[model samples]
Target chain A: MTTSDTSVLAPLADVDPADLARLHAGLEAAADRAGQLDIAYTTFDSPVGPLLLAATETGLLRVAYEIEGHDRVLETISARISPRILRAPKRLEGAMRELDEYFAGRRTTFDVPLDLGLSAGFRQLVQRQLAHIAYGHTQSYGQVAAAVGNPKAVRAVGTACARNPLPVVLPCHRVLKADGSLGGYAGGPATKAILLELESAA
Target chain B: MKTGKPPFEGVVAEHSATVLRVCRAVLGVDEADDAWSETFLAAMRAYPDLPADANLQAWLVTIAHRKAIDVTRARQRRALPVENVPEVATTVPAPGDQDDELWHALKALPDKQRHAVAYHHLGGLAYNEVAEILGGTTDAARRAAADGMKALRTSLMGSKGATR
Candidate 1:
C-alpha cells in the first residue's frame, strides 16, 4: 500500500508465480503439522453471505455468518480454544461439500463431527433438540422448550437457538415462534427466511 | 490477561507476500523460493509462543534472515547447479530492467554488505535489528549498508551504461 514498498520492490514484482507456489508449499507443510494446531478453519461463501467455519481436533466447532464479524469470531476462538489455529481448508473440505449439497437440495442432514465446544449444558441440550426438528419441518419455541424439559423456559429456548454456534448444521432455523411465524435468527432475519424457503421448496 | 488476536490464518494472509518479497530480495530469484518456504514453515512452528506485543513482520524478517544464512551455506556445500524449474518466460532479459539489475547488483556485493543492505533496506529492519541479525555492532551495520548501497548503485549504473 505504500509507495516506499513499490520503489523497493520494483524489480521483483514480475517474479510472482514462483514465489507464490513456494509459499503454498510451505503452508501445506505447516498445515500438515497439526500437533501444534488447536483449531483449523476456512470461509465458505453461501447463499447467505460468507460463512466462517472453524474446527477443533474434536470436530467442527463454530459456523459464523458474516453478520457475526468473522474477525471477532476468530479472536474469540483463539482466546477460548488454544491459540494455535491456522487456515487449513483441507479440514473444512467435508463441511463445505455438505453445505453445498444442502443448499442444492440434494441433502438434508449434515454428517460432519460436531464439536459443541462453544455451547454446552442447557444451551447445548437445546441445540441437540433443535437438530431433531427434521428438514422442512418447523417447531415452535415453546415446543422446543418443553422437549428440553424446561417448559417454562420458552425464552431460554429462544436464547439457545439464537446463540446456536453451528446454525445450518443444527437446523436452528427450523425453530419457529409459538404463533408459527419465523423467529429471530443469529444469521439475520433475511437469511432465516431464505433458509426456510429453501427447505420448504425441497 | 486477554491477549486476543486474529487466527493464525489471518497472520499468514497479512504478511506472507511481504515475507516472500524480502526473501526474494535477500536470496535472489533462483534460490529465493526455497528460503521463503523454510522461513514460513519455521515461523508457523513457533507462531503459537510468539508474544502478543511482538512486531510480527520484524519477527518474520528475522526468521527469514536466519533461513537465508542456512540456505546460502547449504548452496555453497552443494557441487551441482540447481535444476531450473519452468518459469514464466519473459522474452529479452532487457536492460534498464531495474528489477533484474537490482538483484545482480545485490548479489555482487561483499557478503556482509549484501546482508546489511538486504536486512536494512529490503527487510525494513532497524540498524539495531540488522546488527543483531548480522552479529555486528549497530554502527558497523549502518556503515556496511551504506557502503553496500554505493556498490549496488555503481554496478546497476554500469549495467545500464553497457546496455545503452
Candidate 2:
C-alpha cells in the first residue's frame, strides 16, 4: 500500500533510502542490546553454491543449501525456533571461516559449537553420530543406523540425514546409500556429490 | 493462537516503511526514525506471545502510537526555554527533501486529525481500528481523517499557487 492515504500526503510518503538503512542498523543494534535477536544468519558463496548459515546464542543452528531455498529455510527457522532473526554476519563468522577452509581442502574438521536444537529423539541421535564419521570418511546409511545402535533403522537414518539441520558441519553428506551410491541429501544429490568429491580429494 | 508465526524479520521487512510513514506523519522526521526503531524492538520482544493470526499492520500501528506518545512526552519534558523558542515553531524538514511541501502541510494539522489520517490512511487501518487506537467513535475518526486530508489539500494548493 502507498504510504500516503490521501493525494496531499502522497508527496511526502517517500522514506529516504539513507534514513531507512540507518534506522534498520539502529534497530538491529537495539534488538541485540535488548536480547531480542534470537537468531543471526549470513549467506556465503561456497564451492558447491551459496550456503545459508544461522546461529543462536548456543552455537551454530543451521546450514542451508541454496537449492533448499534460503527464504523458505529462514521461515522454517522462524517457525521452529524464535522468529526474532536477523542477517547479522558476525555471529556466524567462525562457522563461515571453517566452512571456507573445509571447502578449500585446508581443513578437515569443524571446531565450531553446534546448537543441535532443531532435531530431536532418534533423529538427533543420528545427527550426533554423524559428526564422528570424520572429514573425509564415508558411511553407508545402514552402517550409520547400526552405529547409532539401531541396525533395522537404516531408512530412519536416511531420513535423519535428509532432514539434517546442520548438514556439512554435522557431516550428513558422508552417510551414503547401502549400495555405496549417493543417497538423498537435503542439499540435493549434486551438492552431496560435490561435498563428497571435495572430501575424497583431500 | 494459530500456532505458526513467520519470522519477525519478515514482519519488519513488510511493514517497516508503513510504520515509519505513520511515525513521520505523527512525530515528524527527526524523531520518526527513533520511534520506528523503538516500535520494532518492542515488537520483536513481544512477537512470540502475539497471536499468530493477528492483524500485524494494525498491531504495529498500535505499538507505534504508544511509542510516538512516548516520544512526544519526552519532547515535552525537554521543552525549550521561552527565549530559546524559534520564530517559526514548525519542524521544517530539509530543503529539497522528498515531499517538503506536503510535510509542511501535514505538520500544520492538529494532533488528532494527524493521527487519524496516519493510522487509517497511511498505516492502512480501518476507521474502527483507528477509532480504537485514537480512543474515539468510528465516525469521529473518519471525520478527523477527512478533515485532515482537506486541510492538507487546501494548504498545499495555496502554497503551490503562491510559489507558481
Candidate 3:
C-alpha cells in the first residue's frame, strides 16, 4: 500500500489494553512459527528521557518513550507493520554507542543511517532543514523554510516539523518560530526545550 | 513520468530508527550502520519505481535486511570478519530489574524468531505483514513468532538457573 495508507493504518492510540495484549500474544505466536527471529533491544538515556530501542534484521525499528507502555507502542507499530517482534539488546549497540557519545559531549554529529520512507515532501524538506541546524544553535520555522528554498512555506515547514519522524536524529527540536518561540513537536515542546538546553550546555 | 519525487526525506524522518533496528538485528551493530546507509541510498534510487501501496516501514526494513545480509556476505567473502562486536551492556536500573531480565530472555531467541517477535511485539506488525517483508507466508511468520514466545516463556520461568 502507499506510505500514506500504511501511516493511516498505524495502530490507533486508543486501542484497548486487552486488545493490545491479544495482538501481542498473536505476534509472539507468529514469531514462533517463523522459527528463530533474531531481534536486539535495549534501553538508553536521551536528552528527552529514557528511551526503549528495538532493532531487527533491518536497522533501528522502534524508539519508544520509556514511560509509555511498550505494549501500546508495539501495537501502534504492529498495526502498521508485521507480527514478528523481538527484544534485542545487542541490536541497539550502534545507536546506544552514538547516543552515549552524544550525551557525553564526545560526538556532535550522528553517522547512523536513517530510513524516512514513510513521510512525504514537505515533511522531508522540513526534516532536512532541521538536520542542518547547528548543534548549539536554533532556527525559526521561517528560516527553515527559506533554507529549503521555499521562503513562503513557513506554515508548511511548521507542519513538517510537527510530523518529523526521526525527531532528535533529524533535530526537529531546533526549529523555532520566527518570533523566537519554540515550535510544536510530536515529542512535546518541553522535550524540545530540554534538547535545546542540553545542546546549548554542551 | 513520475510527477514528483516521493517524500522520501519525510519517510526517513519517520522511520529511520525502525529501519536502523532491523539492520542491527540482521547484521549486528558494527555492520548495521553501513548497511543502514546503503538501504536508504538504495531506497532513494528506487523511490521513483516504488508502488504507492507499499508499507514504507516494511519496505525499508526489507531493503535494510537485504543490505545487511549483503554486507555480511561480502565481509565473509573478504575474510575480514569484524573483531570485537560490541555487546549490549547491562546497566541495572534502580527499579524494574525484572523487566530487564525479561528483555534479556527475549534477546536469547534465534535470529528469525527474534525478527518475528520484534516485528510483531515491538514493531507491531500483523502476521501477513511480517511474512511479506520477511519473504514468507503468514502462517510461517506466525509459527516463528510462536516458537520464539514459547522459548521466552520457558526461559523466563526458569530464570533462576538459566544463564544470565
Candidate 4:
C-alpha cells in the first residue's frame, strides 16, 4: 500500500489519550494486586507437534507439550504470576525463526539469547554442557557429566536435562543415556528422537 | 469491578484488532505476529498495576509499537554477513483496483512517521492519544501524522500523475 491511502485514513483518528493513560494505570494496578501474570497458550502445526511456549520479562520460563487441561496449566501459570494472560502466535518470534531455520536445515546452531533463571545451578551446568554438544553429534550422559567437571554427575546431568529451561536452544536432546539410550525429554522422547533425526538428516 | 479475573482480557478482546493493526503497520505482516505476542505478554505482566481509568486500546497499542521496534532492532542486530543473509524478496501482493493506495504509500514511509500515521489514523486515536503512546505531546503527534500524510499524498499523486 502507498502513503496516499494512509492519508485517507486520517479522518478516522479520534482516540483519547486519557483513556490510554487510564488503561495503562488500570492494568498496572491489576498486575500489582495479582503479583504475577498467568500467560500461557499454545500454537499448532509447529514442527515439534503443537508446541507450547511461555515467557515473562525475566525471560522464557516454560515450554511444554500439548496435553489435555491446557487451561489448568494456564491457571497454574497465572497463580504463579498474575491472571493477566493472553495468547497469540506472534510473541514467539525469536523461537519461531530459529525453529523454522532448524527445520529447514539452514541453521545448525541457535544464537538466540535465553533466560534460564528458573533452572537450578546443577541444571544450569548441565545446560551449558548440552550447549557445547556439536551439531549432528550425540554425547552420553556420562560424557556430559564429565564435561561439566562432575564425572559422577551423570545421573544428575540426566535429571538436569529433564529440568532444562531452554530445551531446543540448549540441545538437551543431544544428551543420551550412558548406554546410548535416547534418555528422557520433558517434551517427550519422541520429540527428542525427531530432533536428533532431523539434525542427522541435515 | 470484581478482581481476580484476567485483567486485560476484556480490553484484549475489544481492541485486539487495533493492536494487531499497529503491529502490522510497524513490522509488516511477516513479523507482526511475534511483536503482537510480546506486546500482550508484556501487557499481561504489567496489567495488574495499570491505572483503572486509562484507555486500554491505546495502552496496548503503545506496548505493541514498542515490541515492534524491538523486533526490528533485534533483527538488525542479528543480520548476518552479506553473503550469509539471503536477499529479501518482495512478496507483498498487488493491491486490488478498489483498494486505497494510501496505506501502501504509508508503509513506504520512515518508521517514525509510519508509526505516527498508524496510531493516529488507522488506530482511530487522537493526536494526544498518539503522543502519549509515542511518549510525545499532542503537537508532536499531530506534526508527525500530518507530515506522514502529506508525504504519502505527494508520493501517490506523483505516481498517478506519471500514469496519467
Give lDDT tens digits, candidate 1, residues B27-142. Answer: 77677778877777777778767888898888988998888889989976672465563332432346667667677667667888888877777677888888988887999998
Better of 1 and 2 by lDDT: 2
> Where does the lowest 10-residue lDDT sum fall in candidate 1 chain B?
B84-93
Categorize the docking of model 3: incorrect
- Cα lDDT tens digits, model 3, B42-144, are 6655654677677777777767667766897887677556555444543332344544444455556776787776666545577888888677788999889
Candidate fnat values, all: 0.61, 0.75, 0.00, 0.28
All candidates' lDDT scores?
Answer: 0.80, 0.86, 0.62, 0.68
Q: What is the DockQ of candidate 3?
A: 0.02
Which ten-residue region of model 4 chain A has the weakest summed lDDT?
A7-16
- Candidate 3's residue-wise lDDT over A54-126, tens digit each? 5555666556665455555554443344323344355567888988887777777777665564366777767
Q: Is candidate 1 or candidate 3 better by lDDT?
A: 1
**A27-129 per-residue lDDT for model 2 (tens digits):** 8778877777799888989987899999998899999989889999988888888888987787788998999899899999899999988889999999999
Model 1 error, position A38 (Å): 3.8
**Could you tell which candidate, 2 or 3, scores higher by DockQ?**
2
- C-alpha RMSD (angstroms) for model 4: 15.3
Check candidate 1 and list the clashing pairs: A11-B99
The most accurate candidate by TM-score is 2
lDDT of 4 by residue, A1-202 (tens): 2234453454223334554444444444444345544442345356777656665645455665665234554555555555566553444566677777888888998775565655668888788778789899999989888888898877888899887756777888998887888988877888899999999998
TM-score pick, better of 1 and 4: 1
Off by over 4 Å in 2: A1-5, B80-84, B87-98, B159-164
lDDT of 3 at A137: 85
Instruction: Kindly report which residue stretches of model 4 are placed more than 4 angstroms away from their true locations once superposed.
Output: A1-44, A68-73, A81-83, B1-164
